[model samples]
Target: MDVWKLNLRHLRSVAMTVRLGNLKAVAKKINLSQPAVTQSIIKIEEWFGAQFFVRHPSGMHPTEFANVLSPRIEMALNLIGSNRVTSTQARAFLSLSKTGSYVAASRDIGISQPSLHRNVADLQSVLNFKLVEPRGRGIALTPKGISVARKFLLARLQLEAGFSEIYALLGKETGHISIGAMPLSRASLLPSVLVAFQKRHPHITISVVEGGHGELIEPVRDGHLDIIIGAIREHPIGKDLIQIPLFTDQPVVIGRKDHPLTKVFEKNACCQNSQIMKLAHYPWYMPGKGAPINVVWRELFNRVPVDIPNIPIMGGSVMMIRQLLLETDGLTLLSPDQVAVELEADWLVQICTVPEWMQRDIGITYRTNWHPTRAQSYLLELLNHHSRK
Candidate 1:
């Protein structure tokens, strides 16, 4: 079912009923009739063509689908809330979450306790869910409440980016882009692009979060990151993400400058002779499972019928691998373009060439439906230009 067809009230009803354990408690907390709350949860189940919660003698137990959908639903509700919830109600909710106490929340927001309570009450009425719960003498959020609070806080940050974009458009010094940098992007492409981007748009703020191929996708998909720059996969990425090709990068085996493998290659001066070298002779640094590099590594090596060693190290941190390869005798497989800076600096040497078929497509991956503001789009344009250069 289309998510936009679902409203804030319906989501809150299901989330709260699940969190609080029963319809009667959820109805009382949200100031809704028990039947209305029951109907809300049923309507959500109908949308999915399956039940989210299993009704029992005592309470509703969340199904596996409900567990999986918890975060996504909260995110959807948060997006809807930006339009449906007032600034005061949102602030009250956010402040309560931050302080974890009614008195502290009121003080932080410059509102009386009763006013804060009323704001929260009104918000709950509109949302049809319980946000706060009795914790000792003060308050705490239910599971559903905690999820909603975190999403709303993050949504507020995403919203503020629009103001920066507006200022940047008007020629004022302002903008922010949270970038999730995958392993390949962290090396040559992103570093060069960031420098050029800063030179062109000095006022823009940029935050780079480094992660593996799989690790970087979710934040960009969820709107926590402005964009993710990395190696594009050959297989289908989810429909939610859009891939824009930048360039192709071939994998290469790298070692220390004075490594025995490089020494033999330079001495023989023959690629055909070098291609027969036994891969198991050396200690290896392997990428972790589910990383794109790991798949490429298995594909390249398995065809040759070599016993892949029990990896001495399995990880995705390029910086650590770079240092390990430089100091110790450990070797790693990576895109040559990723370590161009190191190679040029004479710290590492390429020992073997990657198969042409194994070359990875480097590109930009972002949420398919994301509509970038002028400044955000300007940053993307800069990235597109970087790929060309």
Candidate 2:
């Protein structure tokens, strides 16, 4: 018989009824009249040309055919849920994206005896439908139910393969990679790199987490995060921390175009004078607490200005800081590399390069003992290769 005529709804109904012990309960669960549930049972029996359920005063019960069809019902439900091993939904199903409870899956899928009862009861109510007549402790699939589930599984596999191929084109086909970065780098550079990586090796799956340098490093040490991109600070705690330099930053002093400091340049001038204090009066933008740049600035200046108390003035968003520089005379210190395009565009003019007293390095970092995934290794190789260029 052509199973194409059978539908998942019918299979689901049959699977649910078999698990719930009574048609009355199934009727209540599926929000259908008991008569409607009875009609489904009749139509299924007619299509299958088999007596699948044995009715009794206590409740309906499954026959020999029902026992044979149970496994097929399970496969069908799994296919729909993308739990068939290849669907993107499989990521959520396997508890990789998050956690999936055994009780929840058992109840929903009707693959286990106890869970099947509750799941069917719950599912029938939500779907407002019914399919199987329960018989004692056993359940059976109507012939149509078996046929429908098999068809669904086949179709699901084909659909999953199609999506798999698309992701494969982007390097997600063979491995997994986890990355750690700040929000700006995460939003800009990393996405571009991911797009490039995907084009080269389509089957790899990518994951990301964003946080501070010290906060992000621990994940790298435990083998959770594969690589991190940030300005170097303290080495990650423990002997296992490994790091590879991506690039270094050249420090620069930046101010709004109208700021007096922008026009006045005395090479090797210290920033701690009455004129400089007047310059600092123009709302200085700073990096956040504990950031390497902030720490260095505090140590060199030896005192935090009580004048600019707003924390938004100290943020990591390079673009926002640049925009503030364009619209206001907020002073900010930045890495020359990150500001190159702006400097070239004349949107910003460097007020000062670092005096010999201050400079810092920026680089891509990873744990020492950790090994990178193929995709991760590929990206690092590309970044390193391009840094030299």
Candidate 3:
């Protein structure tokens, strides 16, 4: 189903009918005439090609389809937080927010510019709030408008999930899982899990976006991505996100196989503070400040009485880090699992392991209100299973 094409009022009426079990009560609650409510229900049923309610002398009895769809509809309505918002308004505003100009939005959605402007203006008037403001030649959504747009996007996702669930119950697997993958997961975790999941459920499409936490978190929160997998921050991530810890990973300081530190570490099996202090003399390749590994690297130097080494290069790309380590006399902190192949191939060597307390909690992060469909839930289970091993 094209969720953007759905009439918001009709969808709400269907959800209300499922809750109230009678057309009259649904009409009273939504401020529509009983006949209007009945027509709304009929239109939705016809569009969906399924009967949601079975009429009886007593009241309307919801069908299995209604049982599967109503909760999702209600959840979507709550996320949108307004009944006055028409589907056209939503479609227009979403396009404008994404494209950042009326002309672009109109071109993107195949709507006339004047009509798109009127629809957004009408929506703003109905909601009693300014949704967009002039930004140079383009436009930008106000903070409230951005919030509303995110809710609308998530609501659309909810409706899509409902149809996907219905299709699944009818023996057709149809849905997509979009994942935000951090560097560590891309290297050591996600490949195996994705392979196994695709082998089992080939009909369900999966896409992964690789990025660092800072780049991925906002998209996941705004429903652009389903979940993010990698190291969990030690600080609080706020109430809107839920973190599920998969495993603890101990990081080690690594350098090229023939680097000076490798010879020093080999001579002294036990790493003394002086031996650790020698790291301060070498240039470091590290992630940006405040990343988990960066924090550990700083603390490692703090334990000794040496100034933290200067990070000449700062990034989260393992490929870049590996190449830099081989080409320069530099060192980096990373999980051994992340560079297992390089270590085995004698390209890199672990100079020393960080303290147990510096071990990282690797996991998954998703929106707090996210409810996974059966297939998504199965994928999470597979991630947990593989991470454990």
Candidate 4:
């Protein structure tokens, strides 16, 4: 229908009449007589081959079609009014304009400037308006451009106010925090910390994910996780990352409570070669290779003066490993915390007579350069406080 033939004046008249609800008021506001205002509506209706108003004795009211046109007309008026502004000046009004070259919007939005400019062009086509123009050296907005900038400023103000409230609420512990944890630290350490945090800030939401060393730490480095509780080896700290030692774990050797080794070992005797062979026949449970506990076992086994392959039975869950230790004549390598329940019940007995070689260290690791949110910082403080006691 060649909609470009439609003028902003006609669109504004329609919108004002819809907004004001009667011809006399719209006429007074636009400094036009009542008949002139009525003619403008008639002209627009004829141009579009549609009815825009339904006349009555009390006043003139916009028809259903006129109601539909109001928002588009409002937008048209904005574009027409802001048509005289420079692109820089319009950006200042929109509050999203970048400094330096105009192309920087692509960087801010993570796209190229040409792409954003294309999007702006698409919007102008739909609105049937021109938003910006080049002066001698730089771009300027037409009167319609000024109008667009004013409407954009109003919207930006409302948006900024909403984000400010969200930021403030996050500071107040009203938002959610998700944490990832390594297996060794999950059960005993995290439960205590979570209980304390929930008591103090019941409004904050909390979630925890449990995984192994290789499975968990990358999310922290990529900014997907706020904090992580994983073990760090002494030598492998990566670039642009930091680590903090939380609490250390001492590894222990365990076996079925009634096994013969329970009665045979002296306080510090090396695990006997014959006795190791006897236990090796039973299902052996070991942590994954390269794990700190596994590394300790590798070192200790090499020094034993034996040529065994050093392979142990593999059970993934601590609970399952503990069950095997209780019901069968098997050996399981574990941290003390993994067997707390069994130790309390005497279902599993510590075979402490092994050479001092079996003891290993465990600790919590996290990114060093992370700038934690308020909830995250609060949780870390809770962890620190509890670890001390």
How does each model score on TM-score? Answer: 0.68, 0.50, 0.94, 0.53
The runs of at least 3 residues in candidate 3 whose Cα sits more than 4 Å from the true structure, single-residue gaps closed, are 267-270
Q: What is the lDDT of residue 218 in candidate 1?
A: 68
Candidates in order have lDDT scores of 0.73, 0.56, 0.88, 0.61
Best by TM-score: 3
**Which of 1 and 3 is the better model by lDDT?**
3
TM-score, structure 3 vs. true: 0.94
Q: Write the per-residue lDDT of candidate 1 for residues 318-386, one digit (tens) a residue.
A: 788898898878888887776888988989988877667767788888876565655677778877888
lDDT, candidate 4, equals 0.61
The local lDDT score (0 to 100) that residue 319 gets in candidate 2 is 78
Residue-level error in angstroms, candidate 2, position 100: 9.2
**Best prediction by lDDT:** 3
lDDT of 3 by residue, 231-310 (tens): 99879988999999999988878888899877667632444578778888999999998688888778877888689999
lDDT by residue (tens digit), candidate 4, 276-389: 554445456776886776676656555654443434466457877887777777776666677787877878877753455555434555555443444567788988777666
RMSD of each: 13.8, 17.3, 2.0, 17.8
Give one clash count per candidate, in the order shown.
Answer: 0, 30, 0, 26
